[model samples]
Target: MKRVAILVETALASGRNILAGISQYIREHDDWSVFHPTGYMGATDIAGLVDWDGDGIIARISDPAILKNLKAKNTHIVDVLGNVQKSPFPLVKCDDRKIGRMVAEHFIGNGHRHFAFLGFSSERWSFERQEAFGQSLEKEHGQVSLCHLNPRHQGPAHWHRNLDHVASWVEGLPKPCAMLVASDQFGPLAMKACERSGISIPEEISIVGVDNDQSFCELCRPQLSSIEPNHTRVGYEAARLLDALITDERTSETLLETPPLSLYTRGSSDTMAVSDPALVKAMRFIRQEACNGISVDHVAESAGVSRSVLQRRFKDQLGRTVGDIILSVKLRRARDMLAFTKISIPEIAERSGFNYQEYLNYIFKKHLSTTPVRFREEAGR
Candidate 1:
């Protein structure tokens, strides 16, 4: 049996997912004994492992001392964390550029003209994501504001001061701007800043973040929307690479980048920034009632406009017809359910406002060019 030490934090959902993937790999392949010291926020000490004589190490190396200690073991190693400047071991992580472009596309599709990015100045991943997001927006003739918090700041006092600065910046932004935060932790902070400044979420401002931690996301007043990273894939790949390293099958510093699973839409970034009150009402109605089998007539009636007027106005402002918007919302929900849940196809169809599973399959193939089973399988991999 190979002895492995997992030096990853378990406080965050990402870490948990990674550990689960590693566990799955071990169960399928070989008898592996895993060791991890228990503590909060990855506060476990690496010094204790000096005499454990592990065969391999998988770690999110946050400190140089940990690297030094692990290197002394002369074992096969893989780094799962992407925040470090450089790593001698193989690295597996989410594609930060793809993440940024995905968020930009989602915001732009919702008709946002103004954009912003909130992240830590000291983190390499944050900078990469911010730069990619800004470039994507600029490509579409949109403007993006940038904000960075110094990583050196610590404690509640520094946090409050930073929150004040963020609130001031948010208050000064042009109305209805979309902001993508770096992580789940920072996303709620942005939302709190908006609340302090009296900004209406998804109305005056919209916010999205990386790492779709559902518990953390739902904790905010307007539940946060986030890019769900493929951490499980990251973990599985790390295990595969580490196994190869243990057997001397792989020796190079390989970097594995996985695309995100999907964007988990929520109340925080759910609306478009169109100025027409009727259009706003129609959109709100569609978002809330789309899964209930509501039609264009219902949307038109809710908006207090004729079907012709509603269709024309939707095309003029949102660039999509009434029927298309409803379908889009329903399809988005369907995709989310398929990716995140194990619900039956008939149940998924009912919840996604499709009349039947056959129709859902038809539309999925038409738009996505794949069956729902294949989509779910791809998501799992």
Candidate 2:
């Protein structure tokens, strides 16, 4: 069997999931066995490393000195993290700019005027997200304030700690503001800062983060909303590229992998309206009970509004009818399940509030231009 070395440290659930998806893809159809080294070492260790013949390597590190020292020019190198700016090997990475724009658009769509961004002090991804977010806001004729937390900033020890700075910044922003944290870890941190400062989520302030790590999001009091970066696709594509290199199938100078960004709506950033209360309530009902076979009448009745009036109001405000809004919500739910869960098509359809599998397929194709199976496959399941 062909072998590949995997060097990774600072493992998180998101990273593990990415690798797991890649591993699954490789295991079923290939003769490759993955090897993991103990820890991340820079140029020093790479220079002295001795290795038996293996096809290639997939790694998160992209330090120039390290890759150069490894002296494995003949071995195919797949860089999944995109840390290496320029490399001879193929590269796969989360669509950071799209993620930033997605979060910005989502916040603006929900009727947020004042905005804020919380992220690491200095990082490439952070800069990318900030730039994209600012650009999107400008395109929408809006603006956002930014508060960066230095990586070296100690918690509470330094008077200028990230959380303290963030809390101060949040206190200054106008009410009903939406803040996007760069990473999932910072979501809860930002929330805690809000709690300490007497700020309420989605009411006084709204928040979103990148990386849809369930354990991290669910653990927060008001479950965090996040952007799912399609890490699984990144892994799957990385594996495919590595396999090609292993077999000497193709020799491309550089390969870039891009995936669509998806939003995982949750409590922290679930505000559906500021202009109309009834519409927001109705939309919330549709989102919650779409899987329970709810209808327009049901949503109207639940929101204490007449069906005709609700329909007119929804159309006027959202540019879509109440029924269409419900369908959109159902489709989005179905799409999320198809991408994240291992459920069958029938189950996914039902869970997403579709009457039948064929209906799900039809609507999925109509709206998303893809079948459920294809979505899962592309999602790296």
Candidate 3:
């Protein structure tokens, strides 16, 4: 059996999910033995592992010395980190460009015309996401503003010191703007800045962040919405690459990119940018109750409008009917479960408001052009 060393943290949910994927690959193949020295952030001490003589290594390399030491060992290695600086090892990471495009599409679908991106200046991934998001909005004839934290303002204290700057930038944006923050950590800070400036969320401004860290997302004043990256797929692909490398089946240093699962919608971005209060209420009700088997009539009643009036208004403002909106929400949820969970298709159908698995499959094929099983298989790979 090939012995592998995993040098990734277990503190963040993303990291844990990556480890889970690696474990899953090993379980399925039953040919690999894994070792992870865990403590204090779960970072492996390279010096301590120098003599371990592992056959292959999967690591999130943060320090230059880690690379130097691993190179000396001459073992097959795969990098789970997507650092801007190119490394000698193959990379497995989430597709940041696709993530940005997804965020832009989500905001545009909500009738938002003005957009903004909030990120750190020093992070390459953040810059990539910002650039892609801006390009997407531009293609749709929408405008995007940008705000990046200066590199000098790096840590918590410096970030707090720049709250006024963040507030100023946010306050100057056009009303009813949707903003995408780089990560969940930066999201709450932006929310705090907005709160301090008395900007109304999901009304005057809406915020979305990357990495759906549930605790952090839910802790914000309006509860932040976020893009949930498919880290499990990243890990699984990383393990597969490393296994191939160790077996001499692959030699190229390639980058494997996994698409994000879905956007985890929340209170922070629940409202559309349209001016109709009735339509807003209807959309909100549909999003919240769609998975409970609610119908277009229920949405109209909840919004205090007649079904015909709601249909006309929705078509005018959002370019879609109420039934379409409900189905979209259900389909999004179904896709998320299929990608991120091992739940059975029948259970997914029930949870996503479909009465039957066949019905779900039919709708998936009609709308997504792929069956649920095929989608899940592709995502897992």
**Candidate 2's residue-wise lDDT over 1-381, tens digit each?**
778765544345557756776877787767887766554332123522365456777777546776664455467778776654666567777888898889988987887877788886456677788888888887665777888876666445754366677788888887768888888878777888888898767656788988888777877756788988877777777887778777788656365656546898877886544446677577667656777878789989987999999988887876778778777667767776776679899988877888689998898789889998898899887
User: Candidate 3: worst 10 consecutive residues by lDDT?
Assistant: 39-48
Candidate 1 per-residue lDDT over residues 1-381, each given as its tens digit: 888888888877889888888988998897788888766566346765756787898888765777777778788889887666666777888888899999999998888888888998677778878988989989775668888898767447688988988998898888778999988878777988988997767766889988898778878866789999888888888988888888778456588888999998887887777767788678778877899989889999999999999999988887889888888878878887887689987899989999799999999999999988898899892
Q: Give TM-scores for every candidate, taking all chains together and pairing residue i with residue i.
A: 0.75, 0.67, 0.70
Q: List the residue pairs that clash in candidate 3.
A: none
Output the better candidate (1/2) by lDDT.
1
> How many residue pairs clash in each candidate at the backbone level?
0, 0, 0
- Model 3 TM-score, all chains together: 0.70
lDDT of 3 by residue, 1-381 (tens): 999999888776778889989988998899998888776568656765756887999888765777788778788888887654767888898899999999998998877889998897566678878988999989775668988887556666787777878999998998778999988878778988988998767766888998888768867866789999988999999998988888899467588889999998876886678667787677667767899988878998998989899999988877888888888878877887887689999999999999799999999999989999999999892
Local distance difference test, each candidate:
0.83, 0.74, 0.83
Model 1 pairs whose backbones collide:
none
